[model samples]
Target: MMLPWALDVARERDIPLAVFWIQPATVLATYYHYFHGYGELIASHAADPAYEVTLPGLSRPLRIRDFPSFLVDTTGGEVGKVVNAVFCELFEFMDEQRRNVKVLVNTFDELEPAALAAMREHLDVFAVGPVVGSSAEARIHLFNHAGADKTRYMEWLGAQPERSVVYVSFGSIWTYSKQQMEEIADGLRRCGRPYLLVVRKDGRQEDVSRCLEDVVQERKGMVVEWCDQPEVLSHPSVGCFVTHCGWNSTLEAMALGVAVVAAPSMFDQPTNAMLIEEEWAAGVRGERNGEGIFSGPELARCVELVMGDGARAVEVRKKVESRKGMARDAMAPGGPAERNLRSFVMEVQSSDEARRKDTNTISPPP
Candidate 1:
């Protein structure tokens, strides 16, 4: 969203600019196509949940619900409209300078080869991630130590059995309504799994306090205001993650080998959920009702589908385990992600040197 301003700063200074796309390459391709030619088709069917789009280079067609929420958020009022406008403006800026644009995506090469190749047709694209682990480690060092609440949760996790805990979070920005919060709490309780849920203290805590109180009183789960997410996902007891499919959270789950029950809210989240469930086969997407609320029963069903002693659960776990190995390999020394980063750095350095030489060249007086 802030890419336009960053581009302006880079241009004014004559510095080389590369877009470090925080989302997956598939999402980047979707957005690029939406701006390039498919905006009309998407806009016309924005409210049609069953409408499917076959984007170029995607192996499967995507339903309208699977798109980034901004594209299908017809009833979201002013904020939705503003966000949609911002995306259009941002992509327009990129489209205007497409020739000069280079994208460094936070995904590994083997994960989405087709999508990455499609994006390279229009932009200088590099797949350079699953890079959340090191940054997560760095965050631990910068913070000095975990807080009291964090420590408490860690201890609680220690008490749980291996691969027996459900970790629930919707990233930091999204807050649920009282009804939605109650539904989520009820769902987790119904699933009968020991769970750790994070509810932000962003002034909406009082609204859901009753629901949370019930959860703790029954000893069904533990709720905290905030936590070091990487720590929770890396915990041995955490088996399934009920997530909103935020890019960072998705990557962390992938890197750590935790199965996900996607409950995506907005932005790139829905797309990430699609990748998680359909493309990667690492998890399942929770079903939602007409109101777009993931009801308690549906949530429980999805959770069981991933965590129960079922064939699907076993397959999802196997796929997630495989991807975890792939993520590690991508980040290892001389791996694809590392090699891509090295190549990008060398290109930038070469450009900088050439520019310096051009600036310093002495010309005879005309």
Candidate 2:
């Protein structure tokens, strides 16, 4: 959406512009195919969750429910209409600059090779991420209020058996409703696993403590406002991640080799969930009810399926372990992602040098 302004600024300054797509490359391909020819088909099947669309470059058919929410059921409200318009505009601009522009995505080549290859046919795409993992030495801590026992959760995790803890977090946004929180509490209790749940301070107004009072009292579960996500995911004791399926969270889980219990609600989350469960075979998506909530039983079932001593869990674990290696190789020295990023940097430097040379060359009596 902000691409136009950035492009204009770059052109005015006679500098090159590259679009940084924060979502997965598969998502970019989905939007591209939608604008090119699949829009009408997707729109016609907006109401049908079971309707499947096989896009040209993607490996699997995506059900309507697997698409980003903005691409489906946009007739319900103005928010959808506005979001759809923004994407339409963004892609229209992308079409115009297809030959000249480059897209740098926050994913690796090993993650979505098909989508990346498809996009490269139209636009210069670079896989320059897993762009997290910078040290926190430069981080400024403004909100440090975790009731002063900040290390308590880490301590609790240390005591648990390896691969026994169920870590649940729904990203930084989207507070859970009281009913949702209660259901989650019930699910965690029934699952009978030592769990760590993160409910941000704003969401605590619903009295989640009271909802999970029994679990907390029994020391089976611990609810904190927030914690270092990479640290938590990398913890030896952490087993499965019950996530909202945000792209960053998905990448973190994939890079760390943690099995996922995806509970996606909106936007690109469902698409990411599809990638996790269907394409990567690293997780199971929790089924949502008519009200778009994962009930207690359903959540419990999904968690057990991923984290239990079952054949499916074993399969998921093996796949997850393989994916961790793929992610590592993508970011390793001289790997595809690293090579692509280095080439992009060299291209930019070459362009800047040529521009400078041209500026310095006075007209020879033109």
Q: What TM-score do all the candidates reach, one by one?
A: 0.92, 0.92
Model 1 error, position 196 (Å): 0.7
Give per-residue CA lDDT, model 1, range 254-310, as digits (tens): 998999999987888999999999999999998778787989998899989999999
**The CA-based lDDT of model 2 is what?**
0.85
Which clashing pairs does model 2 show?
A: none
- The clash count of every prediction, one per candidate, is 0, 0
Candidate 2, after superposition: displacement of residue 275 in Å?
0.7
Q: How does candidate 1 score on lDDT?
A: 0.85
